[model samples]
Target: MDARITKAEAALLLPATTIPSRRLAEVEAIRLAAIAARDEAVADGVRRAGQAMLNAAEALVRALVTFPARIDTYRALRRLSDRELRDIGMTRFDIPRVFDPSFATRAANDSPQAPQRAA
Candidate 1:
């Protein structure tokens, strides 16, 4: 019915043939299936990359915020008197060690005077 499809005026137009509907459907189905598969792969790739980027952004934000807080705490701790540090069960020399949990244990163990627990 389309105007672009010229009506056969001669026998050489393959005029007797009707395009098969079933084969057309089959080809269309295969093409659609291929497109769906490609879409799924692209979605999966975006999801994976998005997750990794999200994690990296979270880590960067934490590091940015945490470093400033830790530095501020270190400066504050440095300003404290030995008596004040002792009241908190820490020493002037233990400031850096206190910031690092791995070294905190060693520093605590090295201390001759542990905090006396009240009965």
Candidate 2:
């Protein structure tokens, strides 16, 4: 009753916050943009990873398809005389490793070879 509060002072004393609406909206916009960018980058990385997996799968499939031929070569080598096999720098035990596509190349290189045939 004495020194009564003004309408504006009463409004200021209410529970409502004083943060500017435009500033809040700008901050929210920046956070949303960052989230969207992160989502996009993750999606792109996933897509690339999927593509790499597909490529590896295709290569494995191709290797599987060629397995029979490798086996045939091994059989042919197995049937060869030891002398013949040795001439190619291989022993009977070497056939499987040699014909296997996944064999380490260094092992193959170090394996003995048949002498070069003259032209």
Candidate 3:
């Protein structure tokens, strides 16, 4: 019996004995790419959320800054006489509503001066 294998026999068995290093490398590369993509998506989400928070903060600051001015305007309107208020197309009662965002629409709906919409 022969103790050593021939070159042809070794060549035939080479593929079975060797590890699939190239396939393993490809799988590893794909895994790394997936991790990189997931990290980028998370970073993008965090950036968008931070920007939204900053915008909300800026809006709050602007509202706080303008609040005293709105109060001053309201006080000035309150000081006016009924005749003076009427001259401005508003009554003393309407002064409080002047600062309301929906004032124009509400006044138009409630005013005697507004034209009647036919049924």
Instruction: Return the top candidate by lDDT.
Output: 3
Better of 2 and 3 by lDDT: 3
Once fitted onto the true fold, the runs of candidate 1 whose alpha carbons sit more than 4 angstroms away are 1-18, 72-119
Q: Write down the TM-score for model 1.
A: 0.45
TM-scores vs. true structure, each candidate: 0.45, 0.59, 0.54
For candidate 3, report its TM-score: 0.54
lDDT of 1 by residue, 1-119 (tens): 65564445433576333555787778889999999999999999999999999999998998888998889989999999988887776777778866675755564335657655689
The better candidate by TM-score, 1 or 3, is 3
Candidate models: Cα lDDT each:
0.78, 0.78, 0.81
The runs of at least 3 residues in candidate 3 whose Cα sits more than 4 Å from the true structure, single-residue gaps closed, are 1-20, 81-119
Error of 2 at 66 (Å): 0.9
Model 3 poorest 10 in a row by lDDT:
106-115
